[model samples]
Target: MEKERSSLEEMLDAARKQFLEEDLTTLDFKIEELESRLAFSVTTEGGDVCAFCPTYCVA
Candidate 1:
């Protein structure tokens, strides 16, 4: 993020594009909210499931 007067806007093109060009208009919160994910594959070398999803959530 970069400073412009007061609010911070996303600077990277790749990251900014994900927001559909909507620049930052508010403060960013640090609290977690309704986190969720899914795992459909695994890494054979580590035999570890992909990130975040519970074991049962994996395929």
Candidate 2:
């Protein structure tokens, strides 16, 4: 029973790590894509507002 519990915890930890990695990958891709689209305009406040989704919303 102890071995089984340890194995389950390890699996859960692995899954959590994978989820974080995937989320970062997705965020990186979105940032790159938006930067490409905005080009030199990315630095402006208006541009920043237009380039990404709202922060308050969650999945």
Candidate 3:
């Protein structure tokens, strides 16, 4: 009764922690990928992304 409920709660808590850790790992990878792309975009042409646009792109 009480003992079983306590064990179940502990198991559920452990599962929740594992799920959050997996999500964090995935988010970390995605952040790294986005950061790399952003850095490349900013550096390739010159300064910012606007620097890459052609003259006609301006108003």
- All predictions: root-mean-square deviation over Cα? 12.8, 9.5, 4.4
Candidate 2 residue runs with Cα over 4 Å from true position: 40-59
lDDT of 2 by residue, 1-59 (tens): 99999999999999999999999999999999887886753444342343355542232
Per-residue lDDT tens digits for candidate 1, residues 1-59, read: 23662354434655668575444322222111222112234443554556554553223
Best by lDDT: 3
Which number leads on TM-score? 3
**In candidate 3, which residue pairs clash?**
none
After superposing all C-alphas onto the true structure, candidate 2 shows an RMSD in angstroms of: 9.5
Candidate lDDT (C-alpha), each: 0.41, 0.74, 0.75
Write one digit per residue (lDDT tens) for candidate 3, span 1-59. Answer: 99999999999999999999999999999999989876664554443344445433222
For candidate 3, report its TM-score: 0.73
Residue 40 displacement (Å), model 3: 1.0
TM-score of 2: 0.63
Model 1: runs farther than 4 Å from truth?
1-11, 21-59
Q: Which runs in model 3 stand beyond 4 Å of their true positions?
A: 44-59
| Sort order, lDDT high to low | 3, 2, 1
